[model samples]
Target: MDVKRIVLLISLALVSYLMVLQWNQDYHSPAPSVATSAPAPSVTTASSNAVEDERLHLGEAPTPAAQAASPQALIQVTTDVLDLRINPRGGDITYAALLQHKQRANTPDQPFVLLQQDNQRTYIVQSALEGLANRGRIQFQASQSQYQLQEGQDSLQLDLAATIDGIPVVKRFVFQRDSYEVKVSYLLDNTSAQALETRFIGLIKRDNSVDPSQGEALGMSAFLGAAFSSEENHYEKLEFDELRERRYLSEVQGGWVAMIQHYFVSAWIPDAQQTNLYSTRTDNQGRNIIGFKGAAQRIEAGQQAEISANLYLGPKIQSRLEAAAPYLELTVDFGWLWFIAQPLFWLLDLLHDFLGNWGWAIIVLTLLIKLAFFQLSATAYRSMANMRKVGPKLQQLKEQYGDDRQKMSQAMMELYRKEKINPMGGCLPILVQMPVFIALYWMLMESVELRHAPFMLWIDDLSMKDPYFVLPILMGASMFVQQLLNPTPPDPMQAKIMKMLPIIFTFFFLWFPSGLVLYWVVNNVLSIAQQWVITRQIEQQGTS
Candidate 1:
């Protein structure tokens, strides 16, 4: 086989391997059997019963009360970007829908619900003060059932108060405009003529239900699980199966636990100064529970104490998440190429800010990448041009040594040495750049900012595949053009296979996100332009 055919086969093999690897990573074996139990009560509470303490020590099974759908009033709170409902039963955030992000590109009126508690599923953020009898079971009274951020208001605060054993406890939720993080504070007033000992337990309860968006794509499913961070392990994923078998127990000064799904997340970030116990369990309703319990604090008589934590409920915006907590940005996963993907996303974002268009920004970013590797591509193109220049001579040598494999190989090597050509030089440059291209592909696919962004006519929603296969067709055309400008294989079979690659790639790209296809098309066009210039220069020099 000729050099071009060999390169084509290698490229196809590489792409196939990557596709299989990605498929395995995204959709592994089904999770282990679902374990149903009630949410375990806290052991640090002073009023815990003997059975509760033994269960906590031996790893408790979920209680039956967790599955009871008892009726309770929900308080609605609306901010600039978020619409939320807090359950007064335990001050749990039961429902949260992002007002700015819609459920689909075509549906502007419907918002994306990130957290909710319904008959089929339950996902909520909950926190309660431990040590009091039935703290999480107690009822709290709110000032109002509904609260909205007024016009021109920068922030809004809602308070829920409950008197437990004469200790007045107030749960405050502070929502800010243009932000997804809610500041949750638990204030305890000790007015019973004695010091009160208590600790705060914050957790997220989510059922083992899949997101509707997970089935939207043909290739890979989005990651859905429980993840945590600590000083020892920067980030760790705990699936429902793992929680079922055993609890993930850890003690860290500052860490967070989160329930992450496609495009969005909800985490409980406790105070950084105090030590907290992070763990996970399964509820009786088959819901997964991941959370942290803060260390105990004493409140003197007539004195007040406040413990606060931040609840993040929104899309996985990397910059904002990083500001919220360390390594939190990692929720926007890019697989193993995070180092390269992160910087690529930064550049893409920078370009988007300057160009104000995601599609155009992708094209510009591709151009910049090509320019950065101009020298390497020029060398590869020069090598290909030389091979094309000597194509006739190589053909003559093959015919001269017909039916003699050893002689043909020797003659081709002799010819290559005489012509000062490196048979492998062209492939080296492409191999060196494959990682970056793959990284960029993943970065674009995982970016939430491009979810519903539109480019121009006929190309809306950069995150989804093209409604029509126009971009993929243009990409294939560009690829064919690029092949035409490069050296052709002497072997008939090899040449035919190389010619079929564009067709195969077009079909493969049809399912890819339009933003990624746009990048590939732009890169191919740029490569063709550069190769044309270099090939012309080489041909002229050879004639001279």
Candidate 2:
């Protein structure tokens, strides 16, 4: 393959894989098919007294269960400041491993057994939940007073008293809004004096879906017991009765990570050990799919053991994820070329600053890149140029050694030696830049910023193919011109196949994002212009 064609193939394959990984992780939708999706309000508490600076502290956010919603099928519930998420139908979630709790609004009443699903991406704004649910209490006295959301406070601390066994169990859950970290503090006011043993497991879970038979949709992981039926490729919207969704895992064992459709996920840990966790699901029948039942946990008496965890529910921005945890971000699963995918994003961000528009940014960036490699390209061109210059003599040698492969091979090497031409002059630059070019292509496909971004006239979205295919046609034309200028190989069949490369690439580029095509077009044009200059210089040198 010619240098350009090889780069194009690598770029296409890598881009496709990147998109698939994001689709599975729900990190991004390829072309921004949904436009009205609003930027979510700050999921944080007001800490910076400055009105303009939206500062939120760790102790000021809400839990994950206080909101309700459906994105056409997207489940989002906002109570006070709580943002709750429901896993889509056929998605993976369990009932037992969920953090389910209910609470009343007034006077610091504690929460009850509010249900929780698995890997759901919902959030709870403490104040919002208090106001919206109005007292999410069950068989308990729950009410709220002295609720004031100051515009610039870091956290809203409140006292909670739950009457479990005819005794008031007082605890404090510090809800930090901005950072989404809820700190739970328990005041062991048991007065037993001897010692009291208890377990304090923090709760967070996905919501149940309309469908109950075959839980949330494709690519989600769920386990069925020995008697349970297999659920595969059976999730369809708008069912006659109700949709089946994974309720909650009864227990989570070893390691656990919940997957939400194109949203967010979390891995639950128990004291950072290899202990087993049980799981279950709540069907419409509310039949529990308990994968693990009666799991064991221990708590010491008299002294206090507290639990804390960090929840990440924003867009699955890779850098933010990396900051959150390692191997945590790799859950997105970019293909074998992830090395290229990572750096491509870095390069795109840098180029975007210079060009302003990401589409134009890609174009200018590719052009500059092509120019930077002009020395190598010039070398490649010079190889072809010198080859063409010796064409007449080469043909005369072939004619003399007709039908003899050894004679032609010897004659060819002799000619190259006499002319001091390197047979593989263009190889190094082509191989060196191949990874970078492919990675950039994948970045354009993977980045959320490029979704719905527009190029010049008639081209609206840079992350999608040009609507009219104008850019692809022009890209093909440029490649064809460059191909015409390339050194013609001796074999006629090889020459024919090379001649068809431009057309093949044009079709391939047609389905790619516009930013990618823009890169190719600019590179091809530069190559053509450079070829003209190099060929002209070679002609002059030969004549001299």
Candidate 3:
């Protein structure tokens, strides 16, 4: 491929990826739930003779003005310990509540005095779904931090005991309380050792009262394709075209590794990982709803089945994640990523480390990549130029073959055979570059570092659209000019339609991020220049 051809290809691919990036942001998932349906207890018992509204306030006191309030109908759960931040926009929990998490002053999603709940709450939200993230939280039956260690060593004994039914169930969640991954060593030691029989089960339940219609901006939808349609533009309620979702699970040494990115929550699970405290939702309208209940099995006395797993909770970064295991990075599938997608994410990670900025890193990497592929691109341009020069000959052949499509194909093949031109020679470089393009798409999409990241003028945020529409306009202009430079078969009707491609492409890219447009614009400019030079060189060679 020649430099010009590479530039053109890069431009086109960049434009396509930009569309992908935009799609990821469209469906915004809210944060994880707080507790089951409970709100934090209040410090003061506000009794204004408030309409016998005493039931209106359940916790210790009422919701403080400075604190983000939980829904009025807060019900205290007696399950697992969880802390959550109540977000204002959708009345959803923006952050998760963890073990011993009594009160939080401030969090990533919200900054305010978090509402506190004690034992149980009488106040319930419109539905339990929207109130899952806050105060009157639940507690896991078994806890590791509560476990006492041996005589004089930090090496703690796996001490766990709980009652599932009339039968006493004892098992240790062998993991650090704060960590996402752990090993759950289950020992159904029939203390009686009298061959007691009972069913072993692992289950998490959601509040049945949750109302899905109470929330908005559910999850990413139709990001896989539908954006190209003329009918897709009018719909705002649907997922914006660039949203992405990925779930990666793998078998590792002792247990398994998982990489998960849902709308509101992102998690990475590592091998030998276990957790007794897990939060789940059962609302019909929640985006990316998940529920798992392991099959019930009868346990033999004094026997054990070791279950291990590694879990990660956060953004999709390659280095931080792949360090967890192999192929875990695939959770950030850009768009039909192939072999090189993982490598591309790694490269982006390397660039991010050096440059300390993902947006700039992507730009630098793209530039270097363009330079590296200079030779292939140059050849592609040269080939295209030759074809452009032979336009008259190919046209003549078409006319000569007239109504005989088979003869035209044969004549074209004969001409290529005589000229030593491989009919598919130009496709190789393009095909080879597809993975890199796909990887880059996810690189931008999954990189939380690029979220709200700003570039130079007219592009305040690499993750968002160009506020002035200047970049998109330039993008369309570039596409149009590049299309002009590339030679097409002689057909007046086809040429006219091709001319409309820029306008069409421009409309799709209007809401796309500026960094993507910049890449396309640069690539297009380079392609135009390369095509011009190659065309000139071919003409000179022909004359000689």
Per TM-score, the best of the predicted structures is: 1
Model 2: per-residue Cα lDDT over 189-277, one tens digit each = 44344444433233233332321211111122211111111122111111111212322222222332333222233333233232323
Score each candidate by Cα lDDT. 0.80, 0.46, 0.42
Candidate whose lDDT is highest: 1
User: In model 1, where do residues sit more than 4 Å from their true spots?
Assistant: 1-10, 18-72, 133-136, 213-215, 491-493
Model 1 Cα lDDT, one tens digit per residue, 321-347: 999999899899887888999899999
Q: For every model in order, what is the number of clashing pairs?
A: 6, 84, 65
Residues 76-168, model 3: lDDT tens digits: 211122333322221222334333221221233432111222222111111011111132221124332223323344233343444332334
Cα RMSD to native, each candidate? 4.3, 14.4, 14.3
